[model samples]
Target: MDAQQFLEEFGHIANAPGGVGKLRELILSLAFKGELCVPSNEISATLLDDIERQRLEFNGETRKQRLTRQSNTTTNLVGPYEIPKHWSWVSLSTVGHTWGQKKPEDSFVYIDVSSIDNKAGVLRQSPEVISASAAPSRARKVVKKGTLVYSTVRPYLLNIAIIDRDFDLEPIASTAFAIVHPWEGISGRYLYFYLRSPIFVRYVESVQIGMAYPAISDEKFYSGVVPLPPTEEQSRIVAKVDELMALCDKLEAQQQARRKLQNALRQSTLQAVASATSPHELQTTWACLADNFGRLFHEPEDVDDLVAELKNLAVRGLLSEASTTSPDLEAIKIDCAQMRARYIADGLIRRQKLVGMADCEETYPAHWAVTAFDEVAIVIGGVTKGRDLRGKQVMVCPYLSVANVQRGHFKLEGLKSIEIAADELAKYQVHEGDLLITEGGDWDKVGRTALWRGGVTNCLHQNHVFKARVPSKQLLNEWVELVFNSGVGRDYFAGASKQTTNLASINMTQLRSFALPIPPLIEQQRILSVLSELTKHCNEWCRQMERKQAMSTLLAGAVVSSLTGITIEQEEEPMKAPQTELVAPLRLGTTPDIKAQAPLATILARHHGEMSAKDLWQRFGGEIDAFYTQLKTEVAHGWILEPAPAEMREKLADSVSA
Candidate 1:
């Protein structure tokens, strides 16, 4: 329950994902509670008098008007938590003076929420100057040296800092901040630490109004309680905090350097296995990695490099030996021609232009035959929207876009439907065993392939995704997808696709010309079998790493909770929509959302407006992290509010978090 016990476990705690932040919160909490430093015989009462006298002399106001007026304004005021008897509980207004606001009359430097480096609680030091005529309306608050600027909007972001340097021009902050200039005898650094502590932030959360844009008004913020210490003890606590925080900085830097080293080693070792010239060397290199796997692979993300190397080895005819028999290219061409004739006769698909096949540079077993993608498969573009169909009969059908059609899977949730001419559906409707490949997007997303096995019936693809059907039974969709999604296919796409500012796209002609290495049906199945077995081990390794990470995180939380004397509150159950809508203004501790905000709820499973909404009475009372988690999830998926993926949308959430 003290610094000694916490420091003993610092190494283990810092190894966890978010341990350093928890350690910081604990340090601030203890410092404010009089546990971090030895107390002096001097009590805070003497310092309180010094602060009031200085403030009164500066403002020229009497005690009745300045100190006691609304200082205890609440009906029954009580401090949030007990402090040492030597310390006193005082409102922030008693310790700091509020400043006036004014619009910029001339060019000035503006500091907004974006100006803060939240982690360090310091400015980024990049000043942005605003013109007097072009100043934003929100830039109206004044800032001076030694003043603590704490953002009232999204207060949990910890956008709080003390101005320490002079600006050539007047510095104006956005109205979003509550500027607090400390009175004499109060250390601004100590006040800054207490303001960012968990207990203080929790109090802010409980008093803030509204759910969507929750913010603490300047009035409520100034009325919040602060644990005041004697001037001597304040200086001691600040010094100790700085010393311990410097140690934390060292731990954090060492941990990051270790992870960087591990990642680099994994990449080099995997590269050795991937670049092996023969099956013997591949086995030798892989054995070396397997021998040192425990030392190299410590995170679940490391498996990505391992899996990529496996794919490269598989396509090179190194994972499994090539069979004596070769695929019959003539027979495959004949089968494709017969299917094309039948489709032409039935008006199913268009007559694709036969194009010359391009050569692939990589060497492969002579037993494996090479063919262009169009020779064995029918590749076609999907339907384009915005066409005039005013007089035509149309039907709404679920379709796949670049978002739904992922590299090796589909994101079926929140499926969208579009109206298409009923008769035109035949050409666009995708069936089972079709390979869906993205036409264009980012450099990494171009030519990404996924196989469709009928997750949603009558599903069509949009123009951004290409649908390739292998009508011939000789070529399996599974095999084609494997080759198309492997390193070979990705390399071709990266080289051939038209690229601009990290975005790239490929036309049907480019897709049809892709060189595919074809093996006999039996050999294809054998290679897949080998890949399946090896990837299974890799998958299990990744799962083990995740479980280990979870255990480390749990242990760190438990130790922190025990030492800090904090009861980790259970997360609130998700909010449910009422059977009937209510009229506003709403009451405390009741449903807050009407109907339009219900889309936030729809993001969850089978739930409409299901996001957690606290009744006004219990505004974020139990746990601060629960509220922050809700905000983090919302921000990660906020792009979905556009209901369109113009570009990135928490794509990392699926890839890395998984």
Candidate 2:
């Protein structure tokens, strides 16, 4: 199929567990059956017979090269028409004389099996070796200039490299490997891809003896069956696979680049949107952003950035510019100044001994007054006497803690009850429309405030969270809350905070030092109304996004299930592309639950596919039998996941793989 057609048919398949894997398995199945590419007409019975004769004669004389006889490593005869007319299957050992020794003296480059691609037919560099003392002393395996070296330990790594350079240097390689030097007429690259094809790995993994680190010996490596095509056809298939794989790499890189650019564009647009000063400007910004909203904001971070901008815009009075048309802003400022003077004169409040407001050359709207927050609102410390009353279920009284307050409002869930001395209840009780702020914490979290809309009739807050009660007659609670939570409050809080060892706090003086923009009560309410509406919309947007992400996760999992053939129900037809277990011990890959790990195999047999021994080992691999013994002790004392029979004596096989 063409690239476009393949994508359309199996685009859902990711380079994950099930999706593309199913397609990969199918490709192998077809390739082994001689269906992946067209067969050559040159392959015939006479040519195959000649190759067999050479193979029989070589096997008769070569006792040292004889493969270990294994029931599972038996070879099957291939039909004449099943293979191309000119193609022949021969044992891999037929092409090369053994260069079975390793020598370190020569300038031969050393290669490790780990350096090769286990999944592709390409040899990669071996890990860098630093120890000269560790160099091999045996005569180096002399592979011809065009030889192919296969890492037998992990054949799936597909590390096949063509020996192109005429170097007398002998590279040190693993003993568990077979190097092949292709005969004349057969291209090394063609054989490389064929080795990478699923036929090789599947044959190794299927009849592999033992339960852990299953492997195939050299006998099975050479005797394994492969459908070899004519020399020319082999070259064609190799070229095609190489070209397609390269294109896939390019496509992946392009997609990654596009995603990065989209994220950058979203951030830029969000910044512009926040900086808009007027309704018309905001409208234009919004329109531009909306035009590419679908493409620009697919991720959660983008939505979070948008929310922050929304908060900034709300605090800056851009949420409802029309509300500033009224002239009450100046009137309220004058009233607050008078109130501050009155309080200072009457000794009811503190004087302006704290930091003064910074100078801003640009004047605010004519309808708004730039006044100190303390001048317009009363900032009081909450009660701090609930040390011994944690985690206790008490009567449902309205109580706001630092945890109770969220971004814009209070949360009632998991509310802690407190014993507010009956006589002092009236003094500390919180009412509706009170602004709650954190008194101390990280500098950024210090002034984080939210408006309490009176979820309960009589609630109180702890001393850690400050209470800023707006003068109902002058300032609106919502507007004051927004200012304190916005960039304005953030800047003020950051400046006034005193940072100590691991803690930053804003005292009562700092809270009162904030220079707030005091709008008329009505205009403040209007801005708050606009903010509330937009915030609700943003929240709904967040919910939708979360749902979409959840769906994507599920779909990715479903795609995995489709490829692994783990399911018995053949509910769907084929269409695809690309793109564990083991609990032998509590090692790097093992689980920690010893009691659970102890009976994993028996449990696995009973649970079917619900869970596997591999899962148990993964969960409790570290201590193994010790963990089990401890788990059994815990079970005796009443714990979970322990096998029912505490004395069940099932011996564990040494299935651990290094």
Candidate 3:
């Protein structure tokens, strides 16, 4: 699509996922190319000549140099793209100069690349003051007011900012920055935005060398092409960019507010479904959620949450109707006992006193039975390494570690091999349908469970991954897996695991005691079937969200490509929300006293009083929109006390200053 076409259809895709950010890029590209607004009535041919005169005059040099463009040939130009016929292309070297290297003679504000927050194109924190004696070797570049300091190291990070204010001490930037003191015609604000442009960013990504500390060289950096306009046009472009950027910022905020409202609505709807007791109640609540599906599920993460909630419902026996009679615990135990005998006879597992036990109260369906995990399955710890068995016969085989076992499925790639005594291989060898549960890792990942369908022959498991062999006749592997990875199973592990710092672990005994809710054999199949169908729909929902995002990105990219006369391709990478760890991951926090309280209130109550926004976000199981909205309702009702306003301001200020 051409620029005109894009503008005409802007309303169709300007609010898609990551669309506002894309729009900001389009604005920058358009501004640089002089396509954002009408050209000035008058044009100056000596704009470049005047800028050159100012450079030599500022440097106190009589010598003049010719401008050399860094032609990546991005738009078949002498520069990266075709600019307005009146505007000229110039080298970054011709545009500016930097203060020569110097050793500090006194205390100075050390403005390192870390001081800048690339997002805002400003210093994120107060540059620290360093005494002359303590100054680092790299603290040699001088940055006065109006100078643009662009970090040479890791240029893709876009650690480029203008020195807009003076400091208490003389600000000495780290040598990592290529300080650009622009000539008379260049606007520092305009230059700052130029360096932050998507076009510039893509150029940096292509030219930066090295893997660990990828950076652009001074020689290459100086040769970078700048799309220059008349001095009058520069001011015009900057003004327009500022105006559009402010709109983007406003749009971004509105999008956030909209998402929060959607989240609030979705969360409340899902909660209704989860809390429904009777089948009729479940049906009504589920229908309500289904009715608002369009509003509730916008992103892949939203659908993921739906899937997770479905599993939670499945495990709790709330997904389907239960039989009028309670499940026969004795009959299930009898069947398991018969299976256990065969397991013992084969010398695969040892006899245990208890079938299994639940850590929490049993509030399951009347037709469901509960028992300890070990009753129906052979729960055994895997092989431990570093034993002095040199004399003993051993064989090398692929083994599953905690990393290899993810919830629901095994990640078999990069399977590390371990040497085990040939005799002990059978004990550690995981069979088809055996459940592999991680013993410990990051606290949240400590009890991750995945079913092992044999991929590698004679595969064994590491000590940190426990293997459970559940007989097919006694319990289906799928049913057990569903429960173990559900909210109930996760809660039990989080509460029972021994924790230290961010690490957590559950011992073999704890794994054996895990409570597995058992429905009638026929009901198990029925529930799984229903869950499978629901999950398929949720997956389709996510796919549709992804498809929509992909199309939006392409449309945005087409607009940018056409407007700038540059080929800009949009990569459709799956969005991944970070997994958050909480101090109170599995605790049944205190119940909220406020009747107006909902998700956020309940989470804060669970954590005793207050929790970090990050922690609360994960627990709330909703988007930022819902969480903040619910939190506001609680705080507004005087049910929650927030941090002092002054403290918040200081924290925010310090963050920006850093």
Candidate 4:
């Protein structure tokens, strides 16, 4: 598409997923490919001659000196795409000279890598002036007006900018940058846009060397290819790019404002509904929502919020028109007592005193009775691992771990096998109508439970999971699961769990003591029926949202491909290595006598012998490779056990597949 047509269609494109950012990238790609503006052979020939004459003058200089000089010869460097005959492919060093490193002599304005806003292609703020004596070792490169500073360290960050105006003091840049001084015939802004192109980014990614601190070497960066357009066309491309980028900025700001307004409207409407004290007020608020639903709930997350509100209203008996009748509280109490006595007499459970209802803060409908979880269900713990099952004849059975249980659902992707004695299967085996709950993990994951429908035979659960079985005809498992998965249940579990740093757990005692709101059987059936229908609709809406998001992304890709003639294929993001249990003993590899070592040495020393490499990484923030490198250093010094290579590979593969 032409520039005017692209601009005209931008309003529609900007509403697509990630349209603004993609549009910026597309502009750069087209500009560098000589597709944004028509190339002029007459103008390019004149500029090429002038650049070649300058290159010849510096041919006599030494290799060290030549590193900063332009080259006269065209080395036949091939770019990702074919350019016009008038435009030529040349090394970056052929059109500009890199400024040599110099120490700060006096007080100077210091431009660190962090000072540049790569996305805007400008300095984030004014550079700080620092004295020569106080200057950091990395502050060594000097720059002047028309110079482009491109950070070589972490090139993926695209920290590049061109100096447009003179500074009060001579500007000194971080050594991490390669300072490019464009020749008299070249447009500095044009070159800056070229460096930000996706092709250059891909090239940088291919040549970057380190894991945690990936960077392109100065020699490789200078040798990198760039498309050289005619001097007159370069100015046209730069001006066009500036205009489009400004338009993108405006579009981004407008989108931000629109989202803020939508959020405010959504929050206000939800609050009005939640605060309504009477049925009439609620009906009015709900009606208002229905009228404006198309505008208020534009995203999937908004629909999710609506679904949650619907559930809350249903449980609170606000959804139905029929008013609640007073429940037989005394009769419920008598039935609970009788059920407890029968269980104790049959030796099915131990009789324990129950806590009073005063402990609960929640209020139920008039027709609902408050009861303890233990009064209606039998809560049981799962089998413990690492016991002596190896010594005896055992059956290998699939077992559920904490990972297998998610809120209102089961994730049976990685069911593990455990050896249990054949006779012990009945005690550990899971059955239909059972509610599986997680015992511990992250703080919010303490009580995630889902109903089991006997999907797999001969399955058991680990100690970190708990199974609650409701006696036949007492209460529906689905209703109990719904109650526990609701906000109230989540709050209770969060408050009741034993919390450590970033972790929480709940025991059988706490689970059994949980107070539940129990409505009459008939009322419960009605609530469940309404909830099921609403939940199904919500899930279908979520699926539609996913499809819409996918279509938007595809449309964005199509726009870029059509404009730049380059197909954009999405690549899967690399996953972190999986965490594993450390079975081998660990110790310090370095001697305590050593005065200095790695920065993580102090932290590693504090860890007891039982801690694993993954635990150390969690405690200290660093890339996985760096952690492994430090770990290897300690292992070399006999401070810790070397990890098994086979295990590491297996875990890495698993993570990649997942």
Return the top candidate by TM-score: 1
Better of 1 and 2 by TM-score: 1
* lDDT winner, 1 or 4: 1
Q: What residue pairs are clashing in model 4? A: 587-639, 588-639, 589-637, 589-638, 589-639
Tell me how many residue pairs clash in candidate 4: 5
* TM-score (C-alpha, index-matched) for candidate 2: 0.48
Model 2 segments beyond 4 Å from truth? Answer: 1-6, 9-257, 323-363, 385-399, 411-422, 456-458, 500-503, 567-658
Q: Candidates 2 and 3: which is better by lDDT?
A: 3
Worst 10 residues of 4 by lDDT: 591-600
Candidate 4 per-residue lDDT, tens place, 23-58, comes to 888888878887777667554666767987876774
Tens digit of lDDT per residue, candidate 1, span 1-658? Answer: 4557667877667887688877887788778878888888998889877876786678744444354435654433468666888888888877777566889999999999999888888887876899999999999988888889999998878899988889999999999998788887889998998899887888898899988878999878887888888988999999999998998899889889988998888889988998998878988998999999998998898898888878878887788887889988888888877877787777777776788777689877888888887788787688888978898998999999988877788888888898888888888999988899999888878999999989787789999999988876767778888787788888988888998997999889888888888888888888888998999999999977875775566556556656555534323344443222222222112222221121122233223323223331122222333433543344354511221221212223445658
Q: In model 2, what lDDT does residue 13 have? A: 44
Please give the lDDT score at residue 276 for candidate 1. Answer: 92
RMSD of each: 12.5, 17.2, 18.8, 18.5
Off by over 4 Å in 3: 1-7, 41-47, 60-77, 105-107, 131-134, 211-213, 321-328, 331-356, 570-658
Q: Please give each candidate's TM-score.
A: 0.83, 0.48, 0.79, 0.67
Best by lDDT: 1
Question: How many clashing pairs in candidate 2?
Answer: 44
